[model samples]
Target: MRFIAAFAVFLFHLTMLSIHTPHGIDVLHQFKDEGVREAYNSVFHIAGFTGVSFFFALSGFVLTWSARSTDTLTGFWRRRFFKIYPLHIVTYAAGLLLLTGSAFRASDDLPGVFLLQSWIPDARVIFAANSPSWSISCEALFYVLFPLLLPLIERIPASRLWWWSAAMVAGIFAVATIGHLYVSMEYQFWFTYTLPPLRLMEFVLGIFAARLVILGRWPDIRLAPATVLLVLAYALALQLPQVYAQTAVTIVPVVLLVGAGATADIEGRSRLLRSRTMVWLGEISFAFYMVHLVVLLSARKWLGAEDSYSTPKALLVIAGCLAVTMVLAWLLHIGVERPAMRHWSVRRQDRDRGRTTASV
Candidate 1:
């Protein structure tokens, strides 16, 4: 599911760049007919941004689901840092190397390198050095707060968790409505779209949903129906005004899907998500998400500064870039991510020692 969501974001980026930039092969505009182009945009373009929302929710759910009672806050932080930063640093450097001569700025570089870029309102800063990594900034905020938040979350009585979840959802809707009505368009984009604090609500909801399931208080919502609700909500979101659309419109469905997946796992019912191929892909999904934009942008640069290509050629380019991105992602997962987690992550040495003692 994470892999699928990451790929959706990748597709969204590709289509968006095709529409806005002159550097890439314009995949969407390849169709000469206006109607075909509009149809393509209508179907493929609107829903891709929801992938990020999926990720935010999934992060909360997965982290909460796997959290150990004995785990220390420092230990959790160390593990998360090791899990994400190595890949982020590598990709950030790669993006810098690729954009060497193109509008690079020292001001943006500082925040970007430290994963603080999202704090700034400027898109150039927020999207600096690996544009996709701005989300990491948000994730960092979530990680920092998780230890503090979890104890409070666990304190909520299981019976009342549903109401608590509802309250959070209501809060999200309220924030969205206020932002839509009161905030200016420019600031609204910063506040509702890129701001880490605002985005933290989705993460919080994820935590809440997971706690409900942990207590066996999760609503008895099946995976299929939850999935259907997600699709419907996403479609309805697309029809909404841009302000509301960019807000928490699909948050309810996202939470439901995450909760449903968790329930599926706990019940030991076999699902497509547990399949080996998907499991592998999900493992590398973070790396894939980190590297894909650079891969696409580099491909565009290599394609000789052309503004657009014929439909077949543009599609070929997109396919080729995706292939290369996946290969690089797999290599990064094996080389950088796996090794770092094994050696540098929390309690690896202790775990190994325990295993040795057990074998003896």
Candidate 2:
């Protein structure tokens, strides 16, 4: 499931990279003034966003699965923070340094580099970079809030929890839509795009999925055959008029994958997840996501490649970027995440001993 989600995201980015302004933007611009054309772009615009929603649902399920037992919330947060933050901080600082060196001179789309806004062409013409990491910022906020919110959310009766979860999910999207409309009126694109509250539903949907598993309800989860049918159902749902309606389509496949992972024997599934190749790519997904944009930007400028949207060239760039990002992420995972986790473990053990001694 992790592998599939990772690959889906990679494909999302790959598709996005091919959607360059030089080639596709003209097509987009011709339709900009036309309501039908604009609506079509809006539908396509939501594709990558749908991938992110799937990721959120997956994260919620995975994290809740980890904490299903009456576990110490502090320890849970500590492990999660250590596991995710060190890599993020290191990469973020490095990204900032690269942008500093370039002084936003090479790329007109600077807001993305700093993650101040989405890379919607209009939002791109701004005073920073880190476009790719905006989602990271949203993710970071979710991680922080999850630990605090979970206990309360989980305390709701198992039967009633789904209703609560549904409300929370719906509420988030409702507010985000209203917020987006408000921002549009005021031209607050930065606030509109980066607002953490607007994006919280994706993560909360994930939590709801996890809760379903915890209660053994497994709502919407099914076998591959059933999954196929649901996918058709979800695709039909995409024709609905909501922003990010395609999320309806993605949820079923993700649920099937998660269900598969949960039910599979750990010893057997571990082999699949921990295989030399799958583990390698999973380890590097973080770095691959972060660094691929840099590679694309650098290559476009240095190679003077006019065919930025060419599939062949994009595939080649993906291959090269994946190779390098894998090595780098593995190194960071070992040197940074693994070691920090151990250090936290040692500190926890020490604290436990201290409490025991004081009680004596």
Candidate 3:
């Protein structure tokens, strides 16, 4: 799920890089046929918005499902730090070195460096470094609140969990609808999509879902229907005036899909996510997410300087970038991400006592 979500965002960015920058690798525009270009654009355009919603909800669900009573708040925070920050540092430095100065400002540098960029309303800051990492900023805030949030969430009675879940979904919808009706696009995107507090609604929804699954209250929402719901939601979001509705509309189905996947796993019903290939990809997906844009951007600087390459060459460049990104992501996972977690994520004393607990 992580890798799939990350890849969706990747495709979305690969296309957007061209639209967003002058010298970007223009694969989408390279296609001469208007129908083909529009088809490609539509799919990739929504991919990031929906992918990010899936990730935010998945974060809450996974953390809640895997959270441990024995874990201290500091311990949990430490593990999450090592899980993300080292890779972030590497990418941040790379961004500084690789991205054009015009693309980012000194004022925006601190937020990117500290993984706090998503708080500010400015898109440049949020997208400064590894552009995909804005979501990580949200995850950072989510991590801080999780230890505090989980206990309160657990206090909700099992029977009303569904109701609370519905409320959360409704709140998401209300915010998006209101933003669509009243706010400017700038504020609308910030308020409905990028704001840490607003995005927390989705995170909390996933927490509710985790509780339902834990209590054996999760509905038997089959995958097919859940997927269709997601597609319908995305289509509807596109029709709406405020584009930020994309995340809000599809969030329910995303959580449902996550719930179904979790239920299936508990029932020993699905082997695909657990397969070695997917498991390996999932392990490195974070690195892939962190480094993919940097790789694609660099490719643009060095190899894709043309306004738009021929379709064949553009495809070749994309494949090449993917290959390099996979290698770099693998290297990051092994070299920085894994070693940091192994050595620094958990306290040695806790590990020695066999008290290290499962974490997201």
For each candidate in turn, the TM-score is: 0.92, 0.69, 0.92
Of candidate 2, the 10-residue stretch with the lowest lDDT total is 23-32
Pick by TM-score: 2 or 3, better one: 3
Q: 1-360 in candidate 2: lDDT tens per residue?
A: 444554444444433332432211122222213454445454454454555565666777778777646556676667776766676566655655654344444454344433433333253333234345666656766777888878877887888866876676567556546644665543443443445565566677677767777677764433455447645644654576444354434554555555555654332544666568876776656655555544444444444434433444445655776666556667776787678777773467777887899999
Q: Candidate 1 on 18-79: residue-level lDDT in tens?
A: 32332233545544455655666776675656888889989998899899989988889999
TM-score attained by model 2: 0.69
Backbone collision tally, model 2? 11
Candidates arranged by TM-score, highest first:
1, 3, 2
lDDT (Cα) of model 3: 0.81
Which candidate do you rate higher for TM-score, 1 or 2? 1
Candidate 2 segments whose C-alpha is farther than 4 A from its true place:
15-47, 68-74, 100-129, 172-194, 223-242, 245-257, 264-276, 305-314, 344-360
Residue-level lDDT of model 3, residues 253-346, one tens digit each, is 8999999888877777668888999989999999999998888888776754455665676678789989999999999999999999998887
The per-model lDDT (C-alpha) reads 0.81, 0.55, 0.81
In angstroms, give how far residue 21 of model 1 lies from its true place.
8.6
